[model samples]
Target: MSSAQQEEEVLGKAYDGRLMGRLLAYVRPYRWQVVVATLAAGLHSVTQVVGPYLNKVIIDRYLFPTHAPGSHSLIGNYLPADPWRGIASVALLYITMLVIGFALDFLQTWSMQWVGQHSMYDLRRDLFHHLQRLQISFFDRNPVGRMVTRVTNDVEMINDMISSALVAFFDDSFVLLLIIVVMFRFNWKLSLITLAVLPFMILATRAFRRAVRDSYRRIRVAVARINVFLQEHVTGMSVVQAFNREQRAYDEFDQINRVHLRAWTDAVFAYALYYPAIEFLSTLAIALILWFGGLRVLNHT
Candidate 1:
């Protein structure tokens, strides 16, 4: 990681840890809801595991049964007496899991949002009360727009990631771990091959995240500079026209506009490169899974 990314990581983790500790304290008043939400998340993860297992079972027993040919009633073979029945059962099982997963998803979402927003509302009230406690010099040093961005945009971002994305990420990671365990149980060789690509993908994600974050920060700065320029010009429009300084205003705008354009172009190029690289790597992993697993299945090895 770059030094900038390392610094960001450190700061982010520290802020997140502190905020979450405070947020968790809010659950004392809604302990039952929090418990229910936790259970809902667990159920969602279980559904994720069951969905893939159902697919495996359907493929093995219904779509391409190993013993179907010799399963004649007179042959006394123990293969499914009616493969269609098995398929129907699997279909029902899948649908049931889907419904359960969706319901749990909704419950988790609603509960987490309620808890998060409630805590944030209380926190904002406190912040406002504290803001009243600050001296006038604090207001003088911090621009109103900048302070608003911190209290509004920055706080909202924190709420979004912590309340929603954080829980969802935890649920996803649990599901992912369960999937890996089951996948390896199904076929360890294929699991190993598929997992070998994971590290590279994670590294690429980290690199792309840093690049995109820095690029977008630059874009925002450029946009802000342009806005400041426009604000000044518009505020002084009458004086400019009276002094016949239209040419000077145009020149200033052109310079700011060029900066904005460069910022946008650089951001676009960065994203273009980042997305295609990730897509290429993901595609390569899928192809390898198909090719290698197909061979292994055919060889019964």
Candidate 2:
């Protein structure tokens, strides 16, 4: 493997505070936008939880009305007693929540993307300036493709982290926290039973992360190799043609392209397994909830 490939293959710490701090520095100028995006993400998560809660309320109070007629809570008192009217009101509320969720989602996505683009612009500008000031020996030591990758692909990855990954992390955390609270509030025993599969889920997630990490490293290395190979060969096309090396060059490129294809295939396979594993665990949790909760209901517990 070439030096560039070796460098790309060396995976660093997943979460380095120093690196994160440096990245955040670029985001400092757009702090307000970040705050807005964060808030929007949180609100969107609330909407997600609220949608399910609304469904439960509709079923319990309006559809079935299993509880005593006069025992309705303050919020329930506001709801129409007539089933059809209550359904209409709840349905309207559900639609309103959907619209609000859509707006929040749009705001979060737009603001983060705006921040990401601006941050990347600043980073790329600074990187180019730094490259310009470096000694001639610096250029000699680094391949053009590697430097190009740093300026383009690597910076784009940082943009993606800012625009998608970080926001998603926050949104998911909020959603999970809300779900746990809601679950425990509704039925502590059932919640405990539902969470019993959490350990297995965690283990599966760890394994999935490891597999994906390895695949990502391989993909990065393959990308660098492809860049290096193309830069060298394409630039010397005249020389290659004169020496009748077109077929050889094509064969070499084919090999490098195959490496990239295999790397992507591995990534796809990992994702396929990871999602199904998570879904299976979720199904198991739901099954357990039904079995245990049904017994409680039958026993009038």
Candidate 3:
């Protein structure tokens, strides 16, 4: 199987519905916090949208309509019929948005953390519980490192991916979808232009992901080899000195360090190109929006 396919299979085995369902069963008592947190996320997104709309209105109705850039107005049309009243209204609205956004952000951070750490607590408990149930023969055959790897590093990676990447994916995708819908509503032609380079962006993303994965894998291998070399030489230092094998050990260490350097360089090069390409595409979208939106606004059609 392809590495991508293998990775997916591993993730699937790690997070089967039966497994997660059983895990979430422990969170039944905290369901209220989960529900409230989800609602807060929605409100956060809503307020984010509201802030920008308010800015656009202020620009169009007050700034753009009257004072040119760098010119100070005499506090005329920009002021409402009641200046303090209008100022107070804007301030209150902005404060409300800030308060809501902060509250939601805090709730999200807390909820995701509570859910993640709590789930891990239950999972580790179960894994240890299951490990104890295994026969003594299994333990005799498998090295302690193997078992430690499963319970420690593997579990940590899985938890990090689910809590950080999974949550981020959901939040980012929902926000992106909502933004795209709004953009389409504003101007379908511009939206199409904005999305025209999506395939390229996706391809770039996949390439970067592969590059980083390979770099980290190589780094891990190199580190392991170095560790083994160090352990052998340190343990057998007396024999090595008697045989005068210091030069040989130095050469081996140099080779391992070179491998690590090469892997890191490749990773850096991949991201160096990947990020600029993505940024260029994003800039192109802005240019397209301006060129197209300007035409529509000019024709008033």
Candidate with best TM-score: 2
Clashes of each: 0, 0, 0
- Per-residue lDDT of candidate 1, residues 72-131 (tens digit): 222123335577876777778789999999999899888878877876776677778888
Best by lDDT: 2
lDDT of each: 0.71, 0.88, 0.69
| Candidate 3 residue lDDT tens string, 1-301 | 3342233233223237987777567566667766765666666777776676555545544445544332332233455745456556656776798898888878876776677677677767888999999999877655454455456665666567645664566556656777887777665777898898889899999888877877766655555455656766887899999999999989988997898789788889988999999999999888887888798769964
Best-first order by TM-score = 2, 1, 3
Better of 1 and 3 by lDDT: 1
User: CA shift at 101, candidate 2, in angstroms?
Assistant: 1.1
Candidate 3 regions with alpha-carbon error over 4 angstroms: 1-34, 65-88, 135-141, 215-269, 297-301
Query: TM-score, each model?
Result: 0.74, 0.94, 0.70
By lDDT, the candidates rank as 2, 1, 3
lDDT tens digits, residue span 1-301, model 2: 6665567778899789999899999999999999999999899999998888888778788767777442343357678889899889888988999999999999999999999999999999999999999999988877888788889888998899899998799889989999999888777889999999999999999999998988888887778778878888889899999999999999999998998899899999999999999999999999999999899779977
Q: Tally clashes: model 1.
A: 0
- Candidate 1 local lDDT, residue 284: 84
